[model samples]
Target: MADQRVAIVTGGSGGIGRASAERLGADGFAVVVHYAGNRDRAVAAAGAVTGAGGRAVVAGGDVADETAMAAVFDLADSEFGGVDVLVHTAGIMPLAPVVDLDLDTFDRVQRTNVRGTFVVDQLAARRLRPGGAIVNFSTSVTRLQMPGYAAYAASKGAVESLTLILARELRGRDITVNAVAPGPTATPLFLDGKSQQLIDQIASANPLGRLGTPTDIAETVAFLAGPGRWVNGQVLYVNGGAA
Candidate 1:
């Protein structure tokens, strides 16, 4: 019956998305690794899942686009029966102080982060079978009040609100909606062109004394999507006591 467990992990081409896909596959869920533009990486991630004795498929779409998300869901239905879990990790974070942020940059971030969450959450709410779960991604910036992250923080704030509201709206559907807020994670996006000195400074700020790994956040997602159903409507902060 484990093969009956199908999951769709948005943005699964890299970072926490890829980690969650791998973990879900390891947990016996047939995963659909969804990517926006990185086809090769998405295929590789799916292949890794299959190589680990699990079933997986690669799907491509822009999470902020409703039509694209619908196509992805259709592919999942055609390829693997139905979606049992939806892990929405597709987002964009461009840090800039509000005073210095360009309107276009802010709009792009909102379009990808907030609009993307809305589009994917709508699909999951409508298409996910009973006993399914939806996991949304947030960031610790919302709680940390960090400078140069006004737009990014606002976007994640919307996700947190949406997750809680959707959980309430889905009252008796047997589906749990929740969000995970990760701290400074060492993804390619975060480490690119950053100095080791700055990275170390940021790492030292976390109570855990290090930057978070994608696997660290992915493990929490696996729990929420699997047996952690009782923890509904909660913004589970996996920030290693940083916030």
Candidate 2:
């Protein structure tokens, strides 16, 4: 594994993060599959990586906790030697209109989505090797202005801004920092409270006429993590034209 690349995929327990962890592993990355709380799912993700003839390990932490996340990067160093990519997909999404959203809920969303991103990105920025990539997650709803998504959208807007400044901040380090703003997708996060009719309506509104699959977003994460070198500081909307 001397010449192998290593990827630390946050939120690897499920959804787009799980798909991305497996994809990067298939692409020959030694992976650190990170989870917030789900050990079983994270182990399965690591299994997928190793089953594909790649090296992998499981790490768990709250992304906003510096000590917790630092341990995760240390695991990468100890187990895989070094880190080359950070696909930061760990986040919380709760939908509430601005008026109805409580201060506690708003603050919690900010802490997890905004501060969590900052913490992980900070670790990635410091620890990643030259030519490494940092991919953060955003949402197309920031532009679509969907009702009941104010808290989430505001958080992602911060992510987009952070992605840009961090890319410039890492100038000449040969690291690429970008954000993936996925549109309406079929992940549990996206499907959890909506009705079938609303889901169908969203699918129909997309030019592709379907909800995006987790693998669809994962493919783009793989690209940004690897060969998409020229894509720094940009937010790629992976919404099938829904935005």
What RMSD does model 2 have? 0.7
Q: Number of clashing residue pairs in every model?
A: 0, 0
Error of 2 at 143 (Å): 0.9
Report every candidate's CA lDDT: 0.93, 0.94
Residues 1-243, candidate 2: write the lDDT tens digits. 678899999999979999999999999999999999999999999998898888889999999999999999999999989999999999999888888999999999999999999999999999999999999999999989999999999999999999999999999999999999999989898999899999999999999999999999999999999999999999999999887
Q: With candidate 2 superimposed using the best TM-score fit, by how many Å does residue 12's alpha carbon deviate from the native?
A: 0.5
Winning model by lDDT: 2
Tens-place lDDT per residue, model 1, 1-243, is 535889999999989999999999999899999999899999999999999999999989888989989999998899888999999998887877889999999999999999999999999999999999999999988989999889999999999999999999999899999999999899987787679999999999888899999999999999999999899999988988899
Per-residue error at 141 for model 2, in Å? 0.6
| Global local distance difference test of model 1 | 0.93
What candidate 1 gets wrong by more than 4 Å, as runs, is 1-3
All models, RMSD in angstroms: 1.1, 0.7
Tell me the TM-score of each prediction against the true structure.
0.97, 0.98
